[model samples]
Target: MDNSVLRHDMVDGLEESLDRFPDAVSVAMRSVPRHEFVTDGPYQNRPTEHRKTNTTILAPTAVGRLLSALAVEPDHDVLVVGAGVGYTAAVIAEIVGDSNVHAVDITRTLVYEARENLQRAGYEGVLVDCRDGADGLPEYAPFDRILVEASAVKPPRRLLAQLADGGRLVMPMGVGEQTLVAIEDGDVAEKFGPLSFKPLLVDGEQTGSIVRNRTKREDPEYEGRGWHAGHGWEQDWIDWEAHH
Candidate 1:
């Protein structure tokens, strides 16, 4: 019934199941109360849907993998794309200091939700913004680590550009069979797993959200595009006539 007990069990499960789960990351994960972010089954090591967001609160083991891949250090500036409920950012803030963590979510509703969740978790210093995740937080550029929760065919160049030298960017790559890959200096440094995640969204495709940056036409052709929705770019950005 106690949050601490649940958090403890969550971390214990992670350490048992994952190889090379970093000690620092586990300690940070243990310290954060994930229940503040996801009110349902916060310690289950399973993904849970965020209320009304169509986004998932990542499993603790997945969070453990990303944190370990990023290799975060104390005071490191970290950017988290797709800040679902803010749990991942809060956990990272525990290791990197709340002031040093920044996050972005394309859905405005989730952005507000994440902000509230972080504040309630005592991580009010972490900044969460509503914006397309591919456009990494440039104001906080040169981040020591960047983690993108959504899957993409390739890392967004903007996110890669925002990374500080010697920094790492960990994200799920590919559409059909995603691999959690870590990138350094524009190259893949490591790859792990065949995970499944929702496609990285663009400025206009966020679920339950109205078209942002209007004049950005609502995508009318997406229903026929099959499984690769958005594919990290807006439908209008491509010239269907020329490509076809």
Candidate 2:
């Protein structure tokens, strides 16, 4: 199939799935080349019916639907986690403008690929960093929007702390059966349909003694990653209670 034809088909699928955020969805679909973000594998050649493998590109419809739920704004300063191959980031770059998009991924290869793909698509102002998504980019703190591509048992406090007062965050929550959760003002304001994403993996391992000491010393309300530390739900619940 011609690349342009496939691109059009992907765009059409995005429009169909992202009916809610029409303008944002359309801008992303029209601007980002899906093929550039996908690998030349059996999955890319048969996206319509293919299930994504570990390295496969996410379905266009899924990406579009998630982006629609994010409710991004033109002036929003965005942070995208797990930005594989840069397709989603490129689309977001188009929607929020390149100057406002900052993306990070844990994999070095994915980072390189994303940078190349974004450049190929003529997208500028997107900064791709190879780092752990859970940690987030602190230097660019107080972002207007944050999107996480992977699922976590709980939302990371590091990521939440980076949100501006009114900033919004979209991420997959839960273990076996994940749901797309939207966080705003330290509360889960909206939830999309069920989604299954790979679990987030962070680096390093701390001893139980260290974890115990840290937990004891830290505020009871503050749960840094530690032994028997609760998931994102605990922190999210605390945040919600505090806000409410």
Candidate 3:
């Protein structure tokens, strides 16, 4: 089937599963081409990882749920952490004006791909930057909303600090037990529900200098010791993790 039909079906499926999916979220999902983001088989609701960068385009349900919970407004300035192929960023751009969205990713490859994908999808106005998702786009600071695609043991302080006075930040929090946590007004945090997502990487890349800089060996012993499968950075980054 064509992408337009597929997009509609995906949104319909999401709305059928999630009763509270906002009309804005539904429209955004239906507009962005999932096929453009994932250069593979027919578009489906499941996650698809780009082999080159190891960046996974989140499943439709996950994206739908996260976007619905975010409740993005058309005029709001939004930041998308872990842009991947820029699908979420494009969706947000479709809701909020393209100029109102900024996306960041630590993996330079993913950043470039996201930019290319967004451009091809006619969302070139959406800013896709190559930077640590944790630091956020301080240059575009005080965002009205922030959506983190990766899971973290805890909320990153830098992200919380960058939120606008009454902004809302949504992210998958925890390792062994992960929950969707939303911090509204920067101080008031509420746990939504159990969520599973790939761990948020701070300074590691699947390839290139970032991966080369890692002194630790990738072994079974290092799995939960310093890094986690589902949630990256299990330990080590403690100052912010402990306090927040």
Candidate 4:
């Protein structure tokens, strides 16, 4: 199948489900060649996980919703955390000028590959750095928009501080029940649909560790005694009270 056709189908699928895709975000999605960003995958409306790190290039539907929610302007300074393979950054660069986009990842190898991929995708100006996603690129602080690809229980203070006045930040919030949140002025102003993403690592372990082992107790299926009885049951809260 032709890649362009696939791209159109992917975008069309997202539009059908989402009800709308903003003009700017739609244009960006159409412009970038997502196939170039991944070595092998369906490249439709599903995630393409990297074998080594388990970091995924989010599905077109998810990326469309996120970029649409972000509302990135052509001149806005944007920061993207966990820039796996530079696909999201390239899309953002297509919306904002490439020079206006900065992306960071804790995995050094991923950063290198992302930089190369961005260049290959003709987004050479998008800065790709190896750093903890929690840091939010202080050198490029005061970004007009910040997008975190990882999930966290709460917004990182440093990332929140880096948002320009009246700027927007979007990310998956919560360790157990993650939701896409749009933050403004240090507060979660809006919450979107549920999401599942790897937890953001703040240790700055630049060693390019592919696997960040999470506590087995966090998984609800772990022997059935784990916290949080699956999603939205609030069972974890009751368990916590009992333990206390």
Q: Which has the greatest TM-score?
A: 1
Cα lDDT tens digits, model 3, 7-73, are: 7877888889885699998888877887888866535778876788666778888888888778899
Candidate 3's C-alpha runs over 4 A off are: 210-244
1-244 per-residue lDDT for model 1 (tens digits)? 7889988988998889998798899899889988888888888878887768677778888888888888999999999998988988998999989999999988888889999989988999999998889998998799999999989888988999999989999998987788999999899999887767888888657886555422235454754466555565433464445755
Backbone clashes, candidate 3: 1
lDDT of 4 by residue, 56-102 (tens): 77888888878877889889999998888899999999988999999
Candidate 1 minimal-lDDT segment of 10 residues? 211-220
Candidate 2, superposed: residue stretches over 4 Å from native: 17-21, 41-54, 204-244
Candidate 1 clashing pairs? none
Q: What is the lDDT of residue 197 in candidate 2?
A: 70
What overall lDDT, based on C-alpha atoms, would model 3 receive against the true structure? 0.80
- TM-scores, one per candidate: 0.90, 0.76, 0.87, 0.84
CA deviation > 4 Å runs, candidate 1: 211-225, 234-244
Residue 84 error for model 2, in Å? Answer: 0.9
Cα TM-score of candidate 4: 0.84
Worst 10 residues of 3 by lDDT: 210-219
lDDT of 2 by residue, 1-244 (tens): 8776667666766566454656767766766767666656412323332223245467766777678878887878999988877877888888789878999976666777789888887885799998778889999888999999887877888999999998899998887678999999878899887887765644311112123223233456554445334332233222233655
